[model samples]
Target chain A: MNAITIEGIEKSYGKTVQALKGITLNIPQGEFFGLLGPNGAGKTTLISAIVGLVKPNAGEIRVMGCDIRKNPTEAKKYIGLSPQDININNYMPIGKIMEFQGGFYGVSVKESRRRAEELLKYFKLWDKRKAGRYQLSGGMQRRLMIARALMGKPKILILDEPTAGIDVELRHELWTFLKQLKEKGITILLTTHYIEEAERLCEKIGIIHQGKIIACESPLKLIEQHRLHEKAERSGAFQFVRSGSLEEVFVALTGRPIEEASKKSGEEKWEALPASLL
Target chain B: MGSTTRLAALVQMEFFRFWRLLRQTIVPPVLNTLLFILIFGFSLGSRIKEIHGFPFIVYIIPGLTAMGVMNNAFSNTSTSLHMAKFDRSLDNLLAAPLKPFEMVLALVTGGIARGLLIAILTLAVALPLLKQPLFSFWLTLYFVVMQSVFFGCWGIIGALRAKTWDNLATTQTFVITPLAYLAGVFYSVTILPPPWREISLFNPLFYMVDGTRYGVLGVHDAPLWISAGMITGLAILLFAVCVWLFQIGYKMVR
Candidate 1:
């Protein structure tokens, strides 16, 4: 059975803005899956729906075979979501945060404290357990979010933009920690902007564009398909096109150039593509 | 895990947050009650002999106590929920495996805890000055708990409906505060003339204050049964509305 199954999910914001248009996907048990999407691409909305924060207008979601809408409590027990932003109680200590998170999932206080200590020591936050929230650095706070999410010992972990804004060294450290967690037979779902991050970590990548999944395949398969298409396009005389990287495949699939995102100067460059590319 | 365990955890966290700000939460209400005692109870009350059979100071103590309980209860839930929304931490609670009633119960528990603490503090300070014999402990406890629950539920509704700090404050400022002052806290409506007394009878808080007075002082303006019935009915209505709101995710989830 799959770790998560989303069938015909649809959500809309306000009157005209459709957030998720019949989103459907399946993540097999113990698989590292990545969901990539640009801003306003319904990534957060989809994550919210899965975690029961936002109710979808239509369709159903199941976590480990428990339907979310029908059996929310049972479904929620199997899943943990670490949202993109730090939405923790800022005044509480790290240890207390972990304990409360565990307790919210029905762990006894004594057991929660024991598990909290273990996780804190593993995350290297044991020394700073008593410190205030402001005392922790950005990287430490992000690490705490991961620790808190794991407090429930959830079978499936959903991380939304886990490594968005941090230095390279810290991001690498987090990646190493996440990979270790993945090795423990935990199904991990992640969303990130860094193409290389997804390429390195996620075994299956799903690129969402305008509330629809445009491509869902292994990174290598997506790169190979994009390479063949690029070769087909360069048949005339454009000789020196490098083999398409994950970034190229992402840009080609999403129809938004990464270079255009990087350029600070305001010049509208890309126009509407053919309906086929979309 | 059981739903009871999750509810307990949620309540414990709320209490932890409340007690962490002990000085801010517990001190202001005490001070406010003292000011009311000094200004109205002593100054104006000293000039006047008595409104009912009891001394003026004795007459107003229950009113002030109920007022403090109601206000603290309302603020505890409203401000905390509003801050949760402002900081976006409410999503953390939303993602947990709690039923809507469990969530509401936790918030209500936190509010009542704060409100009762303030009431105890008010009694501690007021008992020394006005040495009145106690009437019924159970009655006082019932009225205090019910009044706090009523306002706490109101606060939840306020927190959900309010989009900004000012919007939340508007209910307290424009509606609750005016009603509280006019609800026979400082002076009895029985002393007022004609239509004003009839108007004061319409305020729900008047029954709350009068009910608490019956419990504390063995004196009441309205019939004891009716006062108890009115406050209890209002509490039930407010609680039902809050539960319905939570179940529907009204203004809580988009």
Candidate 2:
């Protein structure tokens, strides 16, 4: 059985922006999946649609066999989403934040606190439990979000640019944490700009361009097939000379230069989708 | 893990949030009520000894208490929701397994809690200081809770619709403040001549104030049944509106 099944999902903002255009995809249970795309390419939109955050104009999404539209509560129980910016309730103490997240997922206080203790210590955030949001650094904040997401003990964990603003050391630390989650039989869906990170962590990668999935395959398979070779200036515009790295495969496929994302791009695009437009 | 427990957990977070900012949330309003008791109730009371045969100082306590309840309830939900929308944190709540009605109820419940707390604290201080007692405890509780529910739901509507800070403030400034003030907070509506008195009747806050005064002072200008009906109907109507708005995702999602 698949961990997630998305069937012909479409989303439009107001009348002009059609964020997702009939996206259909699936991730098998326990698979480590990576979703990659350029700015405005609809990666976040697709992820949001899967998690039941953004309602699609037309489609069906089933999470662990529960239909997101018809059985949202049951579906949501199976998934824990670490959005690009979940925006921690900055005022609450860190410990309370985790418990509150668990409560939302119907985890009892005792159970939530137990899980909170384990995850916080595992994430190296235990000592900071009583700390305010401002006390944590960017990397610690990102880790807190991931730790909070795990409070539900979800079967499928979805991370949107989880390692966005962290330093190389912290990014590696988060990668280790995520790898641990994957080890525990959790189906992982990650979206990130670091092609190398996806290459190292994902079993399968899906590249979305202009609201459509352009490529979906194993990282090695995608790289071996594309086999970035030097091309002329007009290899149909935006396409660059072949480079061996998966980043080159991404640039080659999307026809856009490497975007200054991770730290900025994903969040900027999210903000750009003005509330007034809805 | 039950639905009710889940709802309480969510509502408890709001209380925690308020406590974290206690100086800003609790102290200011309670002090504002005390100041009004000193400035408007007593200082002004000396100049004008009575209104409707009650001491001017005592006559204004219920209105001030109602004002505190209404404003706190409105601000709690409005500011919280607006900040969530602004920071894009609303996605977390939307993604939670809780139903739309549960989410709405939790937020409204937080509003009610804050409203009632302020009402109780304000009354405790003022009633004892002035040697006043509740003419009817249940009626006072009824009127206070109803007003909180109405404004709390309105707060959600305002936060969802507003795109900017100024946009959120527009309604509070232009609509709620004016209506609250003119709705007989400072004086009896029945004392007004002709159409002015009739105009005051249209404001919902008038019913809240008049009803509260009747409960506190055993005097009211409007019929109790009509006031009761209007407050209950408006509160229920707004509660339904908030629930529908949450389910639809309204301006929170595209």
Candidate 3:
């Protein structure tokens, strides 16, 4: 069965601002799906609707065949979300916060404590278990947030910019951890501005623009199609070899440059050129 | 329904949260009430003999206890909810299996629990200060529970409506504080003139205070049964409003 099914979902904030305009997609169980988009591209809105935070004006969302509107509790049981902002009460101890989050999902106290210990150790936060929230560094807090989301061992994990502000080493560590999680049969839906991360992690990718899915394909297929189109557009003999990176493919299809692409360093920029030319 | 389990879980988590914040939640009101009793109930009681055949100190004890309950109830839910908004941890709770009713119940019950702790602790301390017994044990308990539930719902409503910490404090300042002091906490409404006495009757808090006083001193401006009936009616009304707000995912979850 599909892990998540979104059929004709429509949502609006007030009356006039339409956030998700009839978005529909299905993600199979056990696939690492990447949702690539820029800011204001409806990535967060779509995730919010799927998790039942904001009610959609009209649509249906099913998690493991359970409709969110009709069976919210059952549907929510299969999903976990690590939101973008890291916001937890600073007065409480890290242990207490974990217990409270586990309890919210109906995990028994004894079991939750046992699982919390394992997670804390895995995330390297075991020693800081008794510390108040404000004492933790930013990266440690983000890891704690991820640990909280995994309390129920959910089948589908939704991560929104999970590594936005972490250091490069920590970012790679998180990526490796997530890859290990996918290998253990957890379906992941990730939204990120980092195309490199998406290219490295996801097998299937969907590019969202202005509240709609503009492109959906396997990474290899998307690259090949873009190469074919690029070859067709050129009339004169091309000096440069014919190869297109994900960034090139994205620009070719959307006609707008990726905002984050500009931040690439000089050496990295040279490396991103077509492998055929190199 | 799955909502049932989720509701139970949320309520349990809220209780845990309150327990963790016990110093902030429980200590201040108990101390404040004790201070009020010392200054107003003991120091001032020497000058004023009796108001309506009950000792001045005895009559005001129940009113002060109710005020403590109301204030704590208001503060607990309002501060917690507003903090949830500010910290953005509210998204975690909102994304869970719990429904809106479950969320409301959890917060209101947490508020009620804090209020009850303050009321009981204040009464324990007050027992040594007053010469006369303050209440018929059973009635005092009833009034405390009902008052906590009532103000707990009010606190949730205030929290949901408030956008900032200032807005939360504004509600307490403009609405809860004035109504509480004006609700016959110190004086008997019986001595007030014609229309003013009737106006006092319109305030729901007056019934809570008077009813609690009746429980304690057994002498009240209004009949004991009337006070009980009014408080029960108000509890039902407030509870219904809270439930309706939860159903629509009002400002609380939204």
Candidate 4:
């Protein structure tokens, strides 16, 4: 069964700003899927739509073969989300937050407690388990959010920029933990600004820009395809030249210069990877 | 089976969330009501004498109790929603297998629980200071529960409309505060002239306070059934609106 399937999904904020535009993709069960895009490429919008947070103007989404619109509760049972903003209540203990999240997913108190203990330790937050949200550093809080998401034992996990503000060491540690989760056959869908992360972790990547999918392929295959096309265009004259990096390929496909794409905005842009790539 | 179980789970989570923030969730309102009783019930009761054939302190207790229930109910849902919005924790909930009705029920019930707890706590603290038992125990309990549910729905309405912390503050200041004070917490409607008394009848909160006071003191400015019917009708109306908002994924989840 497909873990997630999107068909002609469309969303617009207010009347003018089209956040998502007729996006369609299918994620196989247990696949590590990466939604890659520059800022304002509608990555979060697509993720939010699939998670049922934002209503789509048109189209359908199916999770584990259950239509999200018609069977939202059933679809949601299999999904867990760790949003981009790590905003938990600072007044509450970390353990309590975890318990609350677990309960929301129908976990019994005893089960929630056990899961919290295990996840807190796995995330290296056991020592700070009793601390209020304010006591943890930024990275620790992000980790705690991830742990909270995992508390329900969801079959599908969506992480939106999980390592955005974390340090290098912690980022590496999180990636390792994520890999372990993937190995257990949990279907993971992640949106990240870090190209290297998508390169390393994603088995299949979909580069989105301006609410459209520009490319959907294995990372290595995408890079190899672009290399072959470039070589063919040059007619063997520049065969000795080093192949272009993913960053270069991304820019070439999307048409937004890398420098301009990296600039921060109030809302992260995830527009279709420039139409040029397709 | 799916809906009921998920609803129950959401309610359980809601309570857990409130328990975690007990200091903010449960404490302040009880303390505030206690102080109101001490200052108004004791200090002012000395001067005001009796307002409705009962000591001033006893007369105001039911109103104050209703106020406490309303305030807690409002704060509980409003703050929870705001925090969810700010921390993005709501997204996790939105992604879950729960329906919008389930979420609304969880939040509204959680608010009611806190409201009930604060009402009980305040009553417990006020008991020692009372000159006598204020009203029939069963009627008082009914009014308190109804008032809590009513205002809890109001809180969800406010939270759904609020986009920022300041917006919530504005709701409390402009909406809840006016409703509480104007609901006749301090004085009887019999003392008011014709036009104002008629206007007071329009304020739904007044019925909540009056019905609750009638329940407690057995003396009421409005007929008991009238007040009860009004409150019940208003609660149903507000609940419908809240449920609709939840179904559409209105401001709360989006």
DockQ rank, highest first? Answer: 1, 2, 4, 3
Q: With candidate 1 superimposed using the best TM-score fit, by how many Å does residue A194's alpha carbon deviate from the native?
A: 1.2
Candidate 1 structure quality by residue, lDDT tens digits, A185-247: 999999876778888999999988778888999999999888766755543222332347777
Of the candidates numbered 1 and 3, which has the greater lDDT value? 1
Q: Choose the strongest candidate by TM-score.
A: 1
Error of 3 at B40 (Å): 2.1
- Ten residues in sequence with the least summed lDDT for candidate 4 chain A: A233-242
For model 3, what is the C-alpha lDDT against the true structure?
0.82
User: Would you list the C-alpha lDDT of every candidate in the order shown?
Assistant: 0.84, 0.85, 0.82, 0.81
What tens-digit string does per-residue lDDT give for candidate 4 at A1-278? Answer: 89999999999988878888999999998999999887777998898888888889899999999888788888888988888877676566887778777777778777878999999998999999889888998889899889988987989999999998899999998899899999999999999878889989999989887789988999888887677556454433233333565554566576543335656432243344455357
Clashing pairs in 2: none
Model 3: DockQ vs. true structure: 0.46
Give interface RMSD, every candidate, in order: 1.5, 1.5, 3.1, 2.8
**What 10-residue stretch in candidate 3 chain A is worst by lDDT?**
A233-242
- Give per-residue CA lDDT, model 2, range B49-99, as digits (tens): 588888888888899998899888898898888877766668888887888
- How many collisions per candidate? 0, 0, 0, 19
Candidate 1, B1-254: lDDT as tens digits: 46777888889878988799988888988899889888888888889888778788878898999999998899989988888887777888888777888888889999999989988888878887657656888899899999999999999999999999998789988998889889888787888898999998899999999888888888888888988999999999999898889777788778
Candidate 2, A1-278: lDDT as tens digits: 99999999999998988899888899999999998876667888988888777889999999999998888888998888888875787677889889888898888888889999999998899999999888999888889989988888899999999988888998888888788889999999998767788989999998887788888999888877767343433354335434655766676676555464332557876787897588
Native contact recovery (fnat) for each candidate is: 0.68, 0.72, 0.59, 0.61
